[model samples]
Target: MVWAGMCAAIDHLRTHKNGKLIIFEKGGGFGGTWRDNVFPGCCCDVYSNLYSFSFEQNPDWTHIYPNQEELLAYLTAVAQKYDLYKYVRFNTAVDEARWNENKKQWDVTVVVNGGKDSEYGSGYTVTSDFLISCVGQLNIPKYPHIAGSDSFEGKIMHSARWDWSYPLDGKNIAVVGTGATAAQIVPEVAKVADHLTVLQRAPAWVIPRHDSIISEWRKSLLRHVQPARQWFRAESMKARESFHEAVTQAESAKAKQMREITLAHMHKQLPDRPDLWKIFTPSYSPGCKRSVLSDDYYPTFLRDNVTLETRTISRITKKGILFQGQESETEFDLIVLATGFETFDYMHPLKVFGRNGRSLTEIWHGLPRAYKGVTIEDVPNFGMLFGPNTNLTHNSLILVIEAQSRYINALVDAVLDVKAHGKHLSLIPKLEVIESYNLDLQKTLKKTSFADPNCNSWWKNSEGIITNNWSGTAVDYQNLVSDVIWEDYEIEETDGSETFVLRRKASTHIGRVNEETHLSTSTLRSAFVKCRSFLNWFCYSWNSQVDTQYEQVLKLSSDSEYNKPSRRLET
Candidate 1:
């Protein structure tokens, strides 16, 4: 999808005569997370309405939860429709991105096909005005540090890298971790495997997932009357947003209702086994970790062929897994680790060097922090799509990604405007402003369920800091990025010599991008028309309005300045 978007962006720029856009992909394929996690039963947890891009709503989604292959296909289709394949350079990993203060461009180093032994090749670097890091959180798989792991004679594989060639049929499988991946894989494997012993260090609270194929007639209705679908999407998002609020807020009616529903569901599922229920039910409030939804997970436990071992495994012996209390070893033909990704180590595969020759790793040694989860204070001309604190426990990620795209595009426009006006440029967020924003975030997080000490989730770091998730609802984040507060940023002018723009108060016109004036009225109108083509490709109410307004603004070229206001559009 990133590749496709990049291609579309580049094509749009080319057609409209905007600016250049280059995309670099580390892997041989485009789909970010979809390309990586090929585990069995891996699918989206969020409803399809909330999960998909708001601009490109998929009316033909087979189920509420789409599997990896379907998602990959959808992304591919999106790319194909947008004609974005040309801009993407696959099998090339970015090694470093160094910001040149003098040149006002990023020197990005990339390692292409840098594989092991004879397969390895030389690396190269490229320079660009903007840098976008779309490397998702779940790209790198996390391996458990079990003793004598290598000593195991049986076939062992991480869930992310599921060896499809190896057969699991009639085999004794010891599946570790009862997280999202495990929940899906267990039921599927139980149908085939002779005996499946699932090692559960911690049990997740599973909710009913009534996933079914939507009727063709219903899909047709959705396609025809998109407003109805849009309404459904809005309501679903609103419900999720409300859920987020309930989780964050101390004691609310919604929160109480949620608790009751969860408990009721739990009781309904595991009526006979309260001991299992006790372990499964979280002590801390819901939304501590990413809330999982699954109807089949609990019923899968009832199967006589499967066993959920609550006892923690001490080590991996030569014969089999050794539990803390068990004398008899549970031997296995195959061991599958369903442990999740290494999220903290973002872009670990590629080396990125920013200002002062400092690596991103060095900058964020203990805790990763970003101003608005997109830009770092020192990292200039670089934007992160799924950056720190942007991960949602309750809402759709596509909304976050789209917001990021808009924000970054605005920054790009600012950069281009500066260049066109014969001015050198650099944009950096104010330290005090960033500190204040983070301080508020910390305060808000302190009042949330994630801050509960009883809950130890991957959302927090080793120091127990909530660095992954946003402190509030998605709307709060959207509001934060709604406008670029110029007072919160430092702009540098370097046409001849670098000079800092004088610090101003919270004024409306602070560091506003200069309006374009070279193009004729007809040419401007034509450009707007070309830009509107994207709207036709991905029709949404927001895009439709934006296109119409943009065309109108172009037609009234004399009043172009009115549209180039200091404040960003609320929509």
Candidate 2:
């Protein structure tokens, strides 16, 4: 859906004006995550309004939680609506993007149809001013490392790579990991499978989805009187935003209430087994992990045909799975792994070389850092939509993506301005700025639900640092990206100069002068002299970068313009 919207925007820029856009997809089609995950009972966890692009709202959503197929259809419809098909080149994967400092363009190398050995054959290179990576987090499917995984006689598959050709009717199925995919799959397969075993590491906190079909009249009302639908969406979004604040804020009443509600739901569902409840209930607080919504997931577990196993698996033998304590091994006709994807790797199979021949991997070796989670230093004319620390466990990710799109567009505008003026410019955030931002982010992350040691989730890396998730509310992020701070970056202009010289004023404060007069160099010296008598000598270093003219302006003014503080800035 995101790629389709991006293409649509490009198309709008094209025929309506003289714009160029080329979309490359590794797969045969352009649905992104929707095209990849074809597992049974796969549906969106977020509400239809929040999940969809704000620019394109589907009032005609068949179910409250639209299935993958319906979502893919919506994307297709969106593509057709904006005539974006012409811009898309399917069956092409990006191999590398090298930044050309001289030309100020990205030299992109793409492997076409898996190279010469495959159908399309050979590789090609394309250069463009701007490069946008729309490949999302959930595109790749993860398979668990198990003994005899390859040696299994029966069919084995990841939930994302479901084989429709092999039927599941009356088969003895063993599903590993009861995450979102397993939650949906269990209900669907329970009806058909003779016996199903669910291997769960830890039970998820499930909320009621309350999914239902939209009536024709409701659709009509939504189509004509769209404000009504908009109002509903607004209210829903407001509630979600409030929830985000409640979760982030320490020991809030709203957070307590949300926790109580989740606990109540869990108790209501599993009244019989306290042991199961103890295992299922999270040690950490709610909202730490991605909150799952499903009415059928708990009820599916109650089915007589299905059995839930919390036992730790020793290994996967050729016949079946072996539990740590169990004497007997559980055999299965088929096995499905619902392990999620490696979301940390933003653009897999795509090698990016920035200025000074630095790979993105080398830059972000330990921790993923980006300026405002969108733009990275040294990677000229490249912006990521839904980049590092932008993924939200609460609320909508689409909101973040939209904000990123706006930032990218603004960046493009900045680049165009440079081009039109015939000025050689490079926009890269300062190293100090990015480092400070990351430090602040780490401070806030330490206090969040994700930092809870009791819980182990995919949101954190091996070091238990959350590389995903925004530290604050969506509104905060919106305000941060709404306007670009030119001072935060260095904009260099090169007119065949022997060496590039930065033309921005240094950010240092000199000594203050009197309230009435501007600060002259003599006055600054006198102020520093006075300060040295009382305070430490190192205080003078703080004002070293302030030029005489700017210092004079600061001295003349009441310092109100510079220090009219509002809220403290978050990292």
Candidate 3:
């Protein structure tokens, strides 16, 4: 069901299907972003209960908001539990993937890094029936375009690639951004740095975080009581869903309330420092850029050793950074670039060719778009997880990933079904379907806060197109991808067949996309969301007989071949 978000959808597919699977990971281990981003104070903004897989809830979390180490540990444990490591090739990268039209398979070239028994850069080729790209958008660290950055003699570090061996006990440090990553790093760095200068390009909306350690009693209760954990998970989902309109609808009442709360949070944290308040207040709307959640970030500026620099940087000298009009360059022992990531770049450096050798990079043209944020029009038997328009601003992305997994599984099922009938078929989304879906998606995104034009963030591309975030709530996204509509795809049968056959599948969700402004239906929609599970259970209890009768009617109308006893049981 759609309600069971993050329930090992991919693992379910692996266990059920009898096929060879290989995972090529560039990193040393299983955790993707969590394994890479190990900067100080790197913790998740989402609550711990909701950030995890629904099927495997960990009751042993120390804090409500988990740090990078804890998250990595959790992911590693989950991987071990599922035995995913056996299928993974550590330190191996995908160099190129091309669709073979004749074989209807993907020819993938991979590079494996040197190990104890292997050479430095050995490469090989592998072929697969389907290829799924899980290389997320935020893997690449983005350094600022400052002149003479290479000339700097001081030690430099990026947040995504942190240097743990370097000591920061009393070093002069300069942080180069005020985004979410910088906010997390600045506070931790200020505790040990002799003098810390923060370079702020723009201020983000800051909010208070009520994080606390989970008590032993509470942990015991969670481990012993299954319903308690489920309830906590649901409550977390509900709370995040309530704030969906706040981010999507700028002029919404919830948005206004959110701004007030954020302002109050800043004032409360740095009460005596009204001068610093002006420097911290965002000129743009709350959701224009990402709104940061922290109780420690704002107060870190109040430290005697810290300085906030909001001037334009001209260049990087051998010693340190030079401001636009300042007389002298600021000297620092170490420089940390908390400059975020290249979020618009998805599956970069991995060249992919689809039908007719059409390049994926050329098709995207610096702006990536996908059919329902998973598949493309010409890319047959291929899919991506956490692709364009699949990021969430108000809730956990685990939910969205689960939904995409299910949707991909549905597509795979369709292909397998066709194969069971002794035929070869390629499933690709229709061009018209892609056009219609993205048209409505862009139209809806124009009115959201992500398109505020006053500020530019990673949520959009360089062209000011909002390509990262979804247009609706996480629940809305879950509903949109609940079922795959066969009519929206062009099923090309490579086998010599006189006519194409149609499959009759009952759809629980259809035409759920192309939604108008979510603000208009806020009240009615929220009520339905709150009571949906209960309502679904109640309806099923009362209508089981009627549903069975309806299924019998559908079976009677189907082809006699499909109506056989074995097919009926399978259906």
- Please name the candidate that would achieve the greatest lDDT relative to the true structure: 3
Residue 257 of model 3 has an lDDT of: 73
Per residue, candidate 1 scores C-alpha lDDT tens digits across 217-270 of 556656876654665565455445545654655365545555665667778887
* Native RMSD of candidate 1 (Å): 10.5
User: Highest TM-score among the candidates is held by which one?
Assistant: 3
Q: If scored against the real structure, what TM-score would every candidate get?
A: 0.84, 0.83, 0.86
Tens digit of lDDT per residue, candidate 3, span 279-301? Answer: 88888877888888888998898
Full candidate order by TM-score, most accurate first:
3, 1, 2
Clashing pairs in 3: none
| Per-candidate local distance difference test | 0.69, 0.69, 0.76
Looking at candidate 2, the ten consecutive residues that score lowest on lDDT are 508-517
Task: Give per-candidate clash totals.
Answer: 1, 2, 0
Q: What tens-digit string does per-residue lDDT give for candidate 2 at 1-571?
A: 3553464365236433556778887777657788788888888877676677666788888765678998889888877876777877777788999988888788999877744435655678998877777776677777778877876778898888889999899999999987788888889988999999999887776665656665565565567656546644553454455566445543655556656666777778877867767877766666666667777777677788999888888887778888899787788889988888877787776898888889998988857778888778777777777777887775677777677666676666666656666765566787788888878988998898777776677778878898887887665676667666667776655565413233322331211111111233355455546643322232242244233212322322322221223422322
RMSD in Å for candidate 2, one decimal? 16.0
Off by over 4 Å in 2: 1-16, 114-121, 421-424, 494-571
- How much is 66 displaced in model 1, in angstroms? 1.7
Q: After superposition, how far is residue 364 of candidate 1 from its true place, in Å?
A: 2.3
